[model samples]
Target: MVATAESVAAAPGWFTEAIAELPEHREVESAGGAIHLRCWGRTGTPGVVLVHGGSAHSGWWDHIAPLLATTHRVVALDLSGHGDSVVRSEYPIEGWADEVMAAAAAGGIAGRPYIVGHSMGGRVAAVVGARHRESVAGLIIIDSPFQEPSGESIVRQLRRTPKAHPTRNDICARFRTVPEQSVLLPYVARHVAEESVRDTGEGWVWKFDPDMLRKRLEQGRIPPLGSLRGVAAPVLYIRCERGLVTPERAREIAALFERPATVVELSAAGHHPMMDQPLPLVATLRTALAQWESR
Candidate 1:
């Protein structure tokens, strides 16, 4: 479904207000394709670029971004094939880094900015830091696995899943199963589900090209943990006590970093620390930023 101003206006109360409050920009060209970027805080200010995980849009950072903006410029984008961003026929994890770089350039974000990412986004941030070492000031990875995936293994996983176009209802139903996801349902049903439409008479369909995820799974291999060792910037890894990234694994990943990355485990949170527990996440972020600046 193609997103337009009128459609966005028709979005639900929460979504409309959220989008309205954010500084939205468009037509930022990246190697993969053009993307729609939504930012907050003053341009040229010290900033943090937030990247969300797979199947999630930049809006997932809604709560955290505003709080971060109060102290530092905070930017988030609807990565290609997700949210309001243009869906491309093909893309990869490295390509996402390029898109981020383009958006940063367009926003006139000179010098390096703190790069914060979650899940798949964490992988992208690592790749970007490795490739454009000077452009990233520091890294904050939330619940990301440091290990790379074998290409063969990824391809096999894709082959097992059937490909099909998803409907708005289909997407909503899937999100309904997760407890954390429940909080986002109202907004999704209004903005995302409503915005994602092709008008087939029967009903509206999802705008995202299903092939993007399939292609990513097949071609995307996480960079080796050693690749991150070369990043000179300090690293902060935050994991939920009950999330996928166990304390043991977090420690193991931290040990791989030559610069001695700090690891923080939020006991009250899950995979989505900010959403599950915003206050603690914000406090942790503030402390981390202060510590990074002091050093």
Candidate 2:
């Protein structure tokens, strides 16, 4: 049930408004490849960059980004090997961090921007915060795990090269999160599913490279959380109630930071809050930024 333009136009008022606030599509060159991004709000406004999880793309934030754009310039990016971004021989988390900064500059964010990342993207954001503390305003990590599981192990466990589907409908029907969740909103899922695919001359297939992890694995090892110990930016760690990060784990991760970190939760939300609890997620993000601005 891929959502077409007609269906999105007919969606509820909130969704209709968000979807109507179209973003300016832009690309910035990175070490890996050209990073594709969608920017909303006027240039020179306070900026915030939203990053999707592994195997997910910026389209996942199509609905959420515009809502946040009311007070901030928002940019959601397709990391290399995902969505329309070029695939690279290696997929290092640090390289993804550089892409985030590059996208911010290319998207016309006037100053250092808050970097918000979900799942594996959160780890990438952590790297940005650690490496460029003076260059970033803050960091918001949503439900990212802090561990050193090998990329090969991750690829073996979660990734499978999907076969081409004969029709768009066929492909959308097969759309699922990597760590499949139980509480995805059907309308949101349908909309994202529609954007997740591309039509080749032969048929339709997912845009993300299935071998993205395998390529990273070839890099020998994924960077561990010890690198995050140097993070100096204020950190807001959002833990979804039904997501991967548990309360105990959240505290442990927070303690690793050089400064204090704030830990909060989204009630009843899954790992993919953009799919299951977008409004709450947006509200939480806005509230966090407001508090930081006042501080």
Candidate 3:
């Protein structure tokens, strides 16, 4: 759904209330660059780290993170090269994972925390679970493709510089997801779209580095099955019925994990569940966390 001024003004009470519980901003250094963090809830609570997809930043979880914060210390980070984080010469899955860990620790997560990631971030979360198994309690991957391209094909889509807009409103109006989905909440869309841009003295432009993907593609650093195989924590694989993971692929991904994994389909959601199905997504996550409490 396109975010119009009318829709934003009429935003549902829940969304307004959730976003009103503003997060505390923080910064932590990782892999030679500063990583930005947005933290919610009380300090010293169990942590939940949220990871956004490629081209997306921490604000993508603004609404969702606050809701998760009721019980857990929830933090969302701007991975290096995205959002407010400084750009890096390289963007590696391992590096992104490091940022996640650093942010979780600095954000006051009391113990081993749950890591939840969407799309490309899901792969990063898997890497964290695999490499730092003892530091993570569980993994939740939402709609990450079962496989990513390899070799030169990774850069088949040539990178382009984003055109700066004369005004922030213009930039926000032009905001669109990389792989556009059919369903989106206008209020949520407006919130993320506005958060996605920054005003350069030149003009308003997207905050994410345009060269980030080029660096990853050049290095052939796409997440590999080895990482998934290395994850030791129990997994919650959330597949949106209308999103990227197909039934067969979902099963394939679950099998890749040596640890126990459960697959739950979110009805009527797209790749971005937080955009189209925030409440249901929250309910699902709460239920899953409760079930894993005794584990």
User: lDDT: which candidate is best?
Assistant: 3
In model 3, pairs of residues that clash are none
Per-prediction count of colliding residue pairs?
Answer: 1, 0, 0
Leading candidate by TM-score: 3
Residue pairs in steric clash, candidate 2? none
* Prediction 1 TM-score vs. true: 0.76
Per-residue lDDT of candidate 2, residues 167-249 (tens digit)? 99888988888678977767788888988899997999999887776677644565554456678789999999999889999
TM-score of 2: 0.93
For candidate 2, the 10 contiguous residues with the lowest summed lDDT are: 1-10
Candidate 1 lDDT over residue span 131-215, tens digit each = 7787788888888876655678667655654333356555434432122432323433344334434445565544455566465
True-structure RMSD for candidate 2? 2.4
For model 1, the local distance difference test gives 0.67
Query: Which one wins by lDDT: 1 or 3?
Result: 3
lDDT of 2: 0.86
The models' CA-based lDDT, in order, is: 0.67, 0.86, 0.87
**154-224 in candidate 3: lDDT tens per residue?**
54654444578899988888877767987789999999998998998989989888777677764455545
Q: What does the lDDT read for residue 136 in candidate 2?
A: 90
